[model samples]
Target chain A: MNPTACLLVIGNEILSGRTQDVNVQYIARRLSETGITLSEVRIIPDIRAVIVRTVTEARAAYDNVFTTGGIGPTHDDITSACVAESFGVPWVHHAETFRLLEAHFAPGEFNAARQRMATMPQGAVPIRNSVSVAPGFSMGNVHVMAGVPRIMRAMFEEVLPTLPHGTPVTSRAWHATGLYEGALAAPLEAIQNHYPTIDIGSYPYRLDETQRGVCLLCKGTDAQAVSAAATAVRDMIARLGFEPYEGEPAKS
Target chain B: MNPTACLLVIGNEILSGRTQDVNVQYIARRLSETGITLSEVRIIPDIRAVIVRTVTEARAAYDNVFTTGGIGPTHDDITSACVAESFGVPWVHHAETFRLLEAHFAPGEFNAARQRMATMPQGAVPIRNSVSVAPGFSMGNVHVMAGVPRIMRAMFEEVLPTLPHGTPVTSRAWHATGLYEGALAAPLEAIQNHYPTIDIGSYPYRLDETQRGVCLLCKGTDAQAVSAAATAVRDMIARLGFEPYEGEPAKS
Candidate 1:
């Protein structure tokens, strides 16, 4: 079994529909490549109690818990404090982080709010941020990063290399235009049962008038099983009287 | 307090980072318009036990629970069964839904997988799907829809009217180029304290080399309070040295 991970997105903007999340997908793909299974994701508000409970629960449940957002130098950014409380540690200023912040900011620019960015839970190790000077931190299994996509990506890249990895997941897809998922479901299920280790999924797309069909995806840690399942899916699509195409068909 | 809603996104593609979710924003905006407060969102893989636990918990916590994905005629699609189990109801074929499927599919096209789409928890009412024939269902306060963006939107539109609403939230925003969120945090907290009902947020954006700043947002059900908080935020930005512009500055 792959090492499981869960993402906790702490932002009101995402919940308010003001900002569309780009972090989840980026982290998901990266985790997959690192052989970590992205098991679950929770998009919660900046409420202290909620954040604390979620962080604690996720830390216990998954091998790694990644939290994005609410790490900025703002009043609503309470993730660090909540995370500290979750771990029953003091939220204290790290000397190195403070020095970094002091060097990054202009004269008199580093106010109390800005100073908040330098604080983290006791015994937390900082994750380097390439985009911004303020670093994300990791305590135990919980990794905290900025909500901004650029900073989050940089932090993830820096932190991921240090984490343990399992067998990387491999995937193959076959698409068939004019083929309905209903007709393919039974046969697909049979294929899935035959290869219990692999995961087979059918995604039907009908974005435009001309483009409509189902894309069959087979994914697993076993590369050979994935390939075999993909071949079976293609054959099934052909048996249903539709030409099977590799990968998703180009949307016109 | 507004009537609360929680969204449950069930899919492996999303967890795999193969697909970026577009349903959350659409649902969040729609819920805001309908005077429903979107409290939390959880994205879980196509796991039956997890789905059942999440659905049951969400139903108990919020006024309405909306689920997207895992409702298709495929091996990975197990949402309906899980939802039925969550509610402790029998997963039975609805006569009306079966008839609709029968009418939509060609002769012999409605296979066992297609038939799965017609099954729902006992005592569930079907939500109309204008985009596809397979109807989403509403069991009590839980609304199940397709994971596909287009289909999810259609089902949400169909089911939203029946849900109870509260006072609609209104928002105002101000943007300031070269202004740091750290400087604004203290005063912003003061403004938020003054108008306890309003939700004040600072979102920092960095696009390209030159475009970077914080966007201050004031949102509440009270229009006057929202406007007042916006004015205060603008004033604070001006006091700090940068000119505050209404709404988000055009991304350049």
Candidate 2:
């Protein structure tokens, strides 16, 4: 099997519901395109003890653990020091990282708070954030990144090429309006049984204030099976007298 | 503190970078609005052992644990069984849940695979899914939900009102575009020193085509202190000759 990976999202703002974690979907979608199955994802508060315990556990368990959030210039941004403590490594000012920040800012612009962003666990290598100079770091199995969606996307894109690839997963979707999931239940199950290797997901959606339907999504490595299952679903929907809308070919 | 909540997103599709986890941000934003601090989030594979262990451990460690994904009818969808096993409870078809399914699906549609969605741990209460009838469930401290973003959001909206609201968390965001993080180091430190209670976050964001800025988001229970710090951030951004964007007023 290809190497597996996990993600740890550390932040109180996330759990408290102040911030929407856009990174997970971004990461999930990106990883899927590259054939890496992100096995698990976790979000935690900005607590040092908890961060240390989580980072250590994930690193030991998974081949690679990607963490987002909690690496900013604020006190709540404590992933760096906690990560260092988890590995029993010293938190040091990364020379190249500091230089990047120095070059980006004017004289005396880099302060202790900003300096906090540069501190990484001893022996960690900076993962280049091509969009912004604030570097994400990788030490052993853990890769720490910014929580901001745009920056996180840039950071992941920078490192994605290096990760291992597995079976490329593909998906197809069929949508039917004006019918509830109950109406499509039998045919959907029949379609799933025919394609044992594929995963058929039924999502009931509402639109335009009145119409309702279940969008049946089939995903698998076998394109033929996915296409067949999707076609079956669309045909079934048509038989029910409702026209089905198959989503444009997009990464699920 | 009211009660701590954590979101566990389980899927191999997320880790290997095949999928981006939007649930973390969704759950985080929802929980923060309700004053429940999300302590941690973990994403794991479809393995039963891992899911069981994590569920048991998290239930013991935190007040509430919300799990998303892996509750569908597919073979990999084993969260319900694992969660039941974790609690040492028998997985049985909940009558009400089955009724909901029956209402939405026909008798032929209610096959073994589709019926799998109705199986819940003994003594579990079904969380309403107005969007779909598969129905999420909760027993003891765990809330098992669907992985799809649309379903997860709907489930959260239904579940949030039932939980106890603790302290109301308030936040303010002040942005400074075109100023690198390195330049505002000292003043940011001074501001942190000035307001110990407010949790200040600096997120560097780059617009699609142009413009780079760090949105300094301050969060806490204290309104005055948060405002003072936010004002300080805006003033500092102005001093640096960078345009700033302040977030709108609190909704609740």
Candidate 3:
């Protein structure tokens, strides 16, 4: 079975709409490619109790829980403490990380605030990234990651090879212009019912008032099933007097 | 207290990274303006049991619950039935909606699939949008909207005026270039502690290689507290010999 994962985005900025979040899409795509099922994603505030409760729940509910944000040195960055509380352990400064960070900064620059980055739950493993000196850590099934897209991607790269893998999920899609979802729903439904193991989806998109289309996609770990479903989708499109295009339609 | 809200985005497309969601930001910003505190946002797939459970839980937890996606004519469109199950209500065709949709389509064009669009839970109120003939519904405090951005925005606009609004939450921000968050974390924490009613956040951003900075934001229901926090943040920035700009910094 493909291991299920949950992404918990812990921050107030996302909920307040202060910043447009690009991290979810990046992590979601990476998880998909790594053959992990990203079951759910949540964006919550930086409150301590909420973070602790969410981490405890998510850690048990999914095979893996990946968290972003709240790992920095600022006051709002409380993921480390909350995660430790959730695990019923004490937050401690890692000897190696403390030494590395202390040496990286100037004598007086390594103050109390910057030193907080070197702390984590006891027995946690560090997940290093190229973008920042402070490392994100992994405590049991939960992987803490940086919120910035560049840093998060790098940390994910470090964690990817370590995860338990399933067959890599892949997809096949067919698209046709000037088609309405209502007109093709029945046949599409039939195709979906036939492929019980794979997921068949119909996405209706409109580029402009003059341009519209529906893209039918089949996704699964089984390569043959995805391809077969795509064939059926293409055939249905052709039967309705539209030229079926392979893969997603180009956006204009 | 501001009326708390939760936005549940239900679709497989978003989870599979097939779509980059714009709905969350739009809803969050509108809720902020409407004086509703958007406490959480969740993205879950289009499974019936999951939908039913999530909807039921979210409706009870928050004062207002907003949902997007899966209100379509396709086979994956199971939100209507699931929502009804969540509320323990019967899913039935609305007489007016059925009549309007039947009249809109040609005699043979309105098939079983198209008819599903007109179905909703008992005692649900239709949320009309200018973009489409099919209506989204508001069942109690749970407002269901379309997946398409244009349609979703219109549905939200329809629901906006009818919602129970709270005191509008507002923010004041000061951003300065060539500053590190580590340098400001100490003073920022002090400011946050002083204004216990408001939220003070320091966000570190990198613009290319040479440009890196921090944006300090103060947000709350109280305008005076927000303004006071902004003054402290600006003073901190100037003390550190950086010229802080009001609002956000230009990304050039």
Candidate 4:
């Protein structure tokens, strides 16, 4: 079984629709590549109680929990405090983080609010940020990072090497035009039952006025099983009196 | 106070980083415009127990709950069944839905799996889909819609008219260059305290190597208060020895 993970995106901007979150997808793809199964993703607001509760629950349920956003140098940024409260640990100002922030900013720029970014839960190790000076921290299994895409990506790169990896999932897709999902569902279910370990997904897409069809994808940890399922899916599509093309359907 | 809502995005493809969800943001923006506060968004896989648990919790916590995805004619499509189980109601084929699907498809095309799309929780009202014939449903406060962006949007537009709306949120943004968030944080906090009703957010952006600054936004139900807070934010930026722009800073 793959090591499971959950991503908690803490941002009011995301919930308010002021921002389209790129962090979740970026982290999800990276986690998939790293062989960690990203089982769940929650996009929550900057509420302290909610954040703490979610962090507590995710940490207990998943092998690793990643939280993005609410770690900025602003009044709305409350992720660090909430994380500390969740762990029942005292929030402390990390000496190395303080030094880094102090050096990154001008003398007058390093004010009290910016200093808040240096604060983390006790026993937490810092996740270095290449884009921004303020570092994200890892307390227990929960990894906290900035909400900004660039900073989040940088922090993820730094933190990924530290986490445990599982068997990477491999996927193959077959696209078929003039095929209805309802007509395909029964045979697809049979194929899925045949290969119990692999996950087969049938997604119908209407790219434009002219381009529209169903894309069948097979994914699993075992490369051979996944390939076999893909083959079966292709065969099923062919049997359904439609041509099956490798990869995703062309969108014009 | 605005009526609170939570969005449950149900799909494994989204969790796997295969699809960037447009539904949450579209729903969120619409909810904001309609005066409903979108409290949370959970992007979960097509798991029965998890969906049931999440739907149950969201229904209890929020005034309205919207779920998108898995309501299709495929093996992985189990949202309708799960939703029925969540409310402890029998999954039944709605006569109107079956008739609509029957008319939309060819005789042989309306198979058993395709018939699944017509199944919904007992007593649930169907939300008409303009893009596709397969109708989404509304049971209690939970509104279920299709995963496809076009279909989801159409369903939402149909269902939104039926739901109660509140006082819409108003917002104003002030952009400033060469101003640090740390320097702005203290004064922004003071402004937040001054107008407790208004929520002030400080967002820092690095447009390029040459352009970097913070954008301060004031949001609330009161338009006057939001405008007043925006003015104060502009004043704060000016006081910090920077020119405050009326809109977002130019990116080049």
Highest-DockQ candidate: 1
Q: Each predicted model: what fraction of the native A–B Cα contacts (within 8 Å) does it retain?
A: 0.86, 0.52, 0.66, 0.80
Global lDDT scores for all candidate models: 0.91, 0.78, 0.91, 0.89
**Candidate 3 segments exceeding 4 Å error:** none
Per-prediction DockQ, in order? 0.85, 0.40, 0.81, 0.83
lDDT (Cα, tens digit) per residue for candidate 3, span B1-252? 988999999999889888888899888888998899999999999899999999999999999999999999999999989999999999999989999999999989999999999999999999988989999999999999999889999999999889889899889999999999888899888888889999998888767788999888899999999999899999989998999899987653
- The TM-score of predicted model 1 comes to 0.98
lDDT of 2 by residue, A1-252 (tens): 446677887776666666666677677776666677667777777778888998898899878889988777765678999989999989999988888777876676677777777789999988886666788988888888888776788888888787767877788877877766655666677777888888776655566556656667788778888888888888988998988887832323
What lDDT tens digits, residue by residue, belong to model 4 across residues A52-141? 999999999999999998888788999999999999999999998899888988768788998899999999999986677788989999
Q: Which tens-of-lDDT digit does each residue in A182-224 have in candidate 3?
A: 9999999999999999898888987677899998889999999
lDDT of 4 by residue, B155-220 (tens): 999999899989999889998887778877888999999999998888888778878889888888
What is the lDDT, from 0 to 100, of the residue A17 in candidate 1? 93
User: What is the alpha-carbon lDDT of model 2 when measured against the actual structure?
Assistant: 0.78
Quote model 4's TM-score for chain B: 0.97
In model 3, the clashing pairs are none
lDDT of 1 at A135: 96
